[model samples]
Target: MSFRESVATATVSRSVHFFPLHLRRDLVRQAAEDLDRYHGKAAADYWRSTCRGLAADLTAKGCSDDEMREQIMDFQAAVQVALLEMHREQLAQG
Candidate 1:
């Protein structure tokens, strides 16, 4: 599968609450980093596109802009935490 596809799959799978919190977070962070490495600016563009789609969909479903922004912020925060954890894991492993 493509990088985007893999990331989407990992995101969806983790969202179902099947994985442990740490593992899910690690997977997300790794997926994001791997995508960024492989696709560069395109990866960031994809993230923006996804966030925009998310906002638009939420708005269409009657969510307010503030709510949408908050949701996105929460997602970003989670990603940041996961990324940090991944970095730490790499350092420890090294």
Candidate 2:
């Protein structure tokens, strides 16, 4: 069963195994832009909601932790790619 890699990956390293953090630069950038007009939890809330929605989508599509373990570059891999993109962008600017 091939799981669709809809969202990009972000590697939030806490172990040798990569976490599936579905964070895309465009999505995060849009979230930042949308949240820029707000402050505090309002901004945080947007990100929280976005992540939740993405998680839900994965679940709805039957993307379980077990399935993640099976795929080569599945949603789990996407998580790392997403974060790496963000970190790269930050580095480029600095």
Candidate 3:
């Protein structure tokens, strides 16, 4: 099934909601770092796509537009912070 289709059917997937809050946050950060490593210059585009997907999912789950926007902003900030920390570590190691 397509991502949108799946999200539309389930309020939250087990893969996501199964985890504790802290673990889920760590997973998000780790995913951002991994995507940056894999996508390099295209990582920003990928991240934006991820946030868009989040918005879609939130909408599917009946979130208000304002709630979706706030969540997306928070998600983007977390990803940016993760990427920045990884970059700083790489620089420090050089």
Best by lDDT: 3
Q: What is candidate 3's lDDT per residue for 1-94, written digit by digit as tens?
A: 9999998778564432212212357757876776777666587677667778877877787676776787777666776677788889989999
User: Per-residue CA lDDT of candidate 2, range 6-93, in tens?
Assistant: 2222333222433343344455455445554567988678656765676666556666655444432343345445556666887999
Q: What is the C-alpha RMSD of each candidate to the true structure, in Å?
A: 14.3, 13.3, 10.0
Q: By TM-score, who's the top model here? A: 3
Question: Candidate 2 or 3, higher lDDT?
Answer: 3
RMSD of 3: 10.0
Output the worst ten-in-a-row residue range by lDDT, candidate 3: 14-23
lDDT (C-alpha) at residue 50 in model 1: 60
Candidate order by lDDT, decreasing, is 3, 1, 2
Candidate 2 off by > 4 Å: 1-25, 66-94
Q: Note the Cα lDDT for every prediction shown.
A: 0.63, 0.52, 0.68
Report the poorest 10 consecutive residues by lDDT, candidate 2.
6-15
lDDT of 2 at 66: 56
Q: With candidate 2 superimposed using the best TM-score fit, by how many Å does residue 58's alpha carbon deviate from the native?
A: 1.1
Residue 55 local lDDT, model 2: 65
- Compared with the true structure, the alpha-carbon lDDT of candidate 3 equals 0.68
